[model samples]
Target: MKKFLKIIAIIVSLLGLHSCSNDLEMATVTKPEDGVFKLMSSADNVTLEKENADSQTAITFHWDKSWYGIDTPTNFTVQIDSIGGDFSEPVVSELIDNEKSYTHAELNYIALKFELDPDVEGQLKVRLKANLKYGVMPVYSDTKVISVTPFSTLNLKYAMPGALYIQGDAVATNWSYPIPDEQTMVQIDDHRFGLILNLVGGKNFAFITSSSGWSDPAYVAPDSTVPAEGGEFIPSGSNTTPAWGGTPMRSPADSGTYKIIIDFVEGTYSVEPEPSIMAVPDELYIIGDATPLGWSTGPSQKFTKVDDFTFAITIALTEGKYDFISALTWSDPAYKAKTGSEPLMGGNFIESGSNTVPAWGGSDITAPAPGTYTITVNFKSGTYVLSL
Candidate 1:
């Protein structure tokens, strides 16, 4: 029995040693920094012809094969950014199948997104990025600059929204986001939306695809220079453009009703004076503790129309607070009591009657020394003046 036990111990020891010898060894390999790769461009200056936008390639971008420590397929892409930019925020190109060619239409769309004016000289910084290992090591190539002149027409892959919504200080909610339902634009057709809005001049507004949140992509004025009325618009938000105003549509400086039309077909927008000022009362009046009406909101002191854009009224005002309203009702659009170019869009001013426990009202302008004063409001210039 002792001899059998000795034999069994020897066999177990031999099997354990063999298993350890067959196991694989492992170690960490530091990725090398030098001689990663280089990116090259076919042309330093490419003039994009509008005629070739559909059928021709603008330029060919290529890069050398990248070698990581391990034998793994690498993902390569080219990033585009404006010249002199930090490259901190860049638009990455889809380099599918490792192809580096870009069509004129694609390049032109990118140029427009970067705010490069068409038919004008612009510079784009291009660089190559390679992911050697997923979520781990990556390498970058030196940036190459290319001068390009994009065409006027831009064709991008941005999907159009089925319905459009607008909100801002100029429209409903008075610049508050998560806009109310009243501000949702009426769909005119497949790609057009027309809405007659009482816009307070001097306040800026923009359009959104979804009314549920502001984080969704929005549309803004095409460029930095915003027309007082309206003009062409472009896509905004981080998903669309890196840097565009959250609300770039500036209303007419004069507070009045305007018909705003947005055309997704042409990627354009227009704002014109509407015949009917449905949202805002045609005339404005004064009502408050300072006014003769005494906040009764029944028979307010009305302003005389000087022109389509101007109104004037000379009335007796005691020392107190007052505000301008378009109508006798407290719910119509009115001018805030503050001294600024901003006009209150919709007056949701809640009035608590004498029987109510809590009272609520809109802001009122303080009278600067009560007496008779002549007040003039100019919508075009977006200014109100009080002359004694």
Candidate 2:
């Protein structure tokens, strides 16, 4: 009887082991079924008010928590694309944390990035993507479509010298850069304005603010001699050129696009004609509190020209603030990143605008640490890189 009982016990133990193994296999083989998920919002159309344009909470998105029957961690990504645009390209793609919402400023910036016309209704498709851990396929919820209108109060203060015009005998038209051309010289600061123009040699030139005619005030040599560096512009009512026999400045002997630097504080200006065949300056430099130069405009670090439109530089940047300029003097034709990110080698190049005015047009580039870095800017491609 004892032997028979031992045999039965062995058989029972083996059968129990088989059943345990089957249970383990079943656990591993389990897969989650598709869950009914959807994205919801109270409002379908949101008109962004300028008052709430700041970095305030703009909108919130709610969705049903997906159930995979397991405690697998999941991630949610919010993607926004223009209407009729497929997921292939989304204007705004961001990962949402525990709180699923975006700020007004954030949305406004995204709208600007999407090139949405201001005050015009634009349609956008928003969708949520849920990713399951441990190799489960990512689940996508139904898209939520919404209409949004964007507005910007970013009124930039035009630096001193509100407007500038270039008129010369060498210029076929009386007004160069044309009337209302973006090239018109504007104040960069209280003291200076800078202009880059194609100047013809041996031609008489003069500075004027009004494009109506030569009746406006003009800048002439202090001694009434051409090519003099120091001069003062007469008041608007004065006919220095048209009535008082004022002298129109003389152009250099060689013809080319020249970078003209004017200092209102010192009442002085300098002309640097093109050094090569290119019309624009071949190099650009950085100046501000962040640079070692400390706005002294010196021995400014130089940018390397990779191509006609691409320029780069590498140097140790401090922890404060900085800006880029075409020359040493504080003036217009300065540049700032366009407030975004671009893929660089190890990191991203903060994007910037070309030849921004007022020196403070874009956010300052901050150094994550005091170290040497390479900064590259491409105007044609509209990209910039600051990498260590």
- lDDT tens readout by residue for model 2, 226-253: 3533345433335343554456676677
- TM-score between model 1 and native: 0.38
Which residues of candidate 2, in runs, are more than 4 Å off?
1-36, 49-55, 67-74, 82-99, 117-121, 153-155, 159-170, 175-197, 200-256, 259-272, 275-388
Candidate 1: where are CA atoms >4 Å away? 1-36, 69-71, 94-98, 154-388
Clashing pairs in 1: 168-175, 169-175, 254-379
Error of 2 at 151 (Å): 3.7
What lDDT does each candidate get?
0.66, 0.59
* Weakest lDDT window of 10 consecutive positions for candidate 2: 342-351
